[model samples]
Target: MRPYRSVLYIPAARERALEKAQTLPVDAIIFDLEDAVAADEKENARVLLARVLGEADYGGRARIVRVNGLDTPWGAEDIAAFRGAKIDALLIPKVGSAADVEAVARLIPDVPLWAMMETPAGMLNAAEIAAHPRLSGMVMGTNDLAKEIGARFRPDRLPMLTGLQLCLLAARAHRRIAIDGVYNAFKDDEGLRAECRQGRDMGFDGKTLIHPAQLAIANEEFAPSDAEVDLARRQIEAFDAARREGQGVAVVDGRIVENLHAATARQIIARAEAIAERAI
Candidate 1:
């Protein structure tokens, strides 16, 4: 029940951003060595990231490193550099199949693996990728997916729904963490809020963010709200009371609280507790 309310990506090449990231109220930091870094600066970024990761103490925030695809010249070296480094997970880019995960897993057998679900093939084969024993999470790369699929920008994300749902379904079915794609317009706080709400409703564990400005909104939207926590507590209490009375169902605010509802309520309470622990 680790709360992944806001996951921010910081370019590995930018030392200042990397340093600033330690203080941000983000649940996880993806040390991006792929899309964010320029081609010429790849090696330098990888070396700098390895050094920073060794020295920096990011507290409870999960430290994940996004390595370039194995097809690229820097990708293999990128994986090799972080083999023994301290990291929560290794994110493999453009992972289309379980075999892709296996290749990286063979190189770094100990660390958990996360896959970037972006390409069309990746969406189609998401179930297999999510089912991989070493895989721990799935990240939606909407920018790449939209570009590859020729999708136009829409507020409701109508065009991207299929791919998003596909990866989400796979992640959920495999019991893996499912993080939604970034909202490109960092300055549009309202738009970011709307999308975050949408993702949270759709069962994504959290949203991946491109900029620090997007962190607060994401953290707010993904975490359990005060009202939600209150409702969860009431529901759990009602359900327990009913069970003690030899009843199978209970009522909470005009809604029935069945066993399934109680289960969900317990999870909500646990998540809220976990978030509180993170704050402390």
Candidate 2:
């Protein structure tokens, strides 16, 4: 799981979701606790999550748990309860600072952490948070971010671009994979696809998804298109041929090509290949 590009959603306390997890064509599955769970059912959700994690084998898919933030009543119990659970990574919610990250890291030293940047405070200290070695990546929580910042949501996301770019920079500075927030419209496939295109162009590894319908689009958008994969293959082949002929750079289809371009092409091909294997 080299930074999943199509992380899936498995509803908290939903046992059928756990069974679906085994067959879903997703790069990763986030067992959620924050938004999908109701207040009265929090304990029940945790217990079910524990059992699902303890017993289910998610094949090669990642199994991440989106635990409540420390400020919430259930947060501490969420952290402590993972003592014997087999979770791959802990998705800490509303992480405000590096110290907050350190606090969770201290409690669970063995598990990798993906901090959510959903508050103004979280965005301000993103650079510091990214510097943590135990930190695997960042997930933008748009709804919480909007609520915290008192900002209005635009369909074009113009108001949030600067903040999104800031988070992207922090992740890039620390060589971390940055994941975009969900589009929030499960019924609007066009809306979701547009957001997915934006996320991909903006350099996010993937977009955090909410519903099952979003999974295929996320996987398809983030992964290279067939044309891109073909071009990448052509670029690699040309580069190899040039290298064998004692050349530093190669020209394929009249376009200048270098090692950097070839490397990028390889990443594109790799994701496409993964999607292909999953399809089978």
Candidate 3:
């Protein structure tokens, strides 16, 4: 899990995105080597990732390389170059089954894999893919998935939740992170914020981002809200007082407080406090 609460994407270009990464407020950076880089620039991108990974500590932000799929020409070299580069995770594109994940795991036994749930096969095999030991999480590539399956986008994403929840359930089953896909409307700040909130409500750890403009909103949406934090603190204090009294549960704001609620409160407080710690 690595204690990540928010992640932002940086396009693959040694010149353009590198300078940007040094300034952004994000928990992790997905240095894009797959879709963002031109075919001709992939080699340069690989070199850039290696150099970036080797040189900088990334300001506490986890560095990830989004490699091309194993079936592509650049994929093999991407893996070969990135394995020893100190990346926190290897983002594998278009993973269909646990076998696909296992194959990559065999190649890089130590690095964790983030499976892309993009195609039909991927959605169908989501559970199996998440079952792999090296599978650290699933990221939805919704644009590609929609194109591949001809799924229409909705105002509320009702059409996509089945696939999205499939990935979420699998990740939860394996105790892995589930991240939402990039919201394509980068220019529309309101839309981006709405999508981020939607993804968070859907139980995603955080949404994948395509632009630096989306960073602040993603971080805001993913972090515990003031109301939530206050509630969590109250729950924790109430439960602690109850435990001191040898009570298993206690009333909190007229609600029946139980251990499950206490556990959630503890997690929320920890995450909120962690976020505050990072800010300091």
Candidate 4:
């Protein structure tokens, strides 16, 4: 139940941003060497990031590197450079199939792999991609998906629902971490909060963010509230008492608490505890 509440992307080429990220209250940092870096700086960014990762102590923050796609000229080299580097995961962009995961897995056997689910083919074959044994997470690439599918911007994201839901379903079915796409409006705090709430309600583990300004809202929206935590504790206690008396169900605030509900309650408590522990 590790927290994936606020995953921020920092360009690998920017030394100052990389140094500053070590202090940000983010659950994870995506050391981006793909979309964020210019073509000419790709090789230099990879080298610089590898050096920073070795020397920096980011505490409990998960350090994941987003590499260019294998189809790109710099992709294979990016994968090779991080082969022995200390990283939690290697994020492969435009991953359309399990074979795409295998291509990178063979090179970096030690670290876990995460996929950028963006293209139409990727959405349709999400099950196979999520089922890959080495894959640990799936990130929604909403901007790219919208561009590829010719979708217009809408507050509700009606046009992007199918692709978002498809990848989400696959990630859950395979028990992989599912993170929603970024909200491009970095300055729009209210808009970000609304989308974060929507993603949380849809069962995403967290949301990917493009800027540091988006971190606080994301961490708040994805984490369990005090009221929710209290209810979970009460539900568990009530369920335990009911089972002791040969009862199969317990009532909490007029809602039935069965084995399934108790199980969910336990998970909520565990997730909250994990987040607290990370803070420490």
- Evaluate model 2: give its TM-score: 0.93
**Would you list the rank order by TM-score, best first?**
1, 4, 3, 2
lDDT of 4 at 268: 93
Candidate 1 positional error at 29, Å:
0.4
Candidate 2 per-residue lDDT over residues 235-278, each given as its tens digit = 99999999999998999889999999999988888877766676
Candidate 1 segments exceeding 4 Å error: none
Q: Give the TM-score of candidate 1.
A: 0.99
Tell me the lDDT of model 1 at 71.
Answer: 98
The residue-by-residue lDDT of candidate 4 on 135-228, one tens digit each, is 9999999999999999999989999999999999999999999999999999999999999999999999999999999999999999999999
RMSD of each: 0.8, 1.8, 1.6, 0.8
Candidate 4 lDDT: 0.95
TM-score for each model: 0.99, 0.93, 0.94, 0.98
The per-candidate count of clashes, in order, stands at 0, 0, 0, 0
Off by over 4 Å in 2: 1-3, 278-280
lDDT: worst 10-residue window of model 1: 271-280
Global CA lDDT of candidate 1, please?
0.95
Mind giving the per-residue lDDT tens digits that candidate 3 earns over 130-192?
A: 999888878888989888878787758777778888998999999988889888888988988
The count of backbone overlaps in candidate 1 is 0
User: Which pairs of residues collide in candidate 1?
Assistant: none
Give the 10-residue window scoring lowest on summed lDDT in candidate 3.
Answer: 1-10
- Candidate 3 ranges beyond 4 A from true positions: 1-3
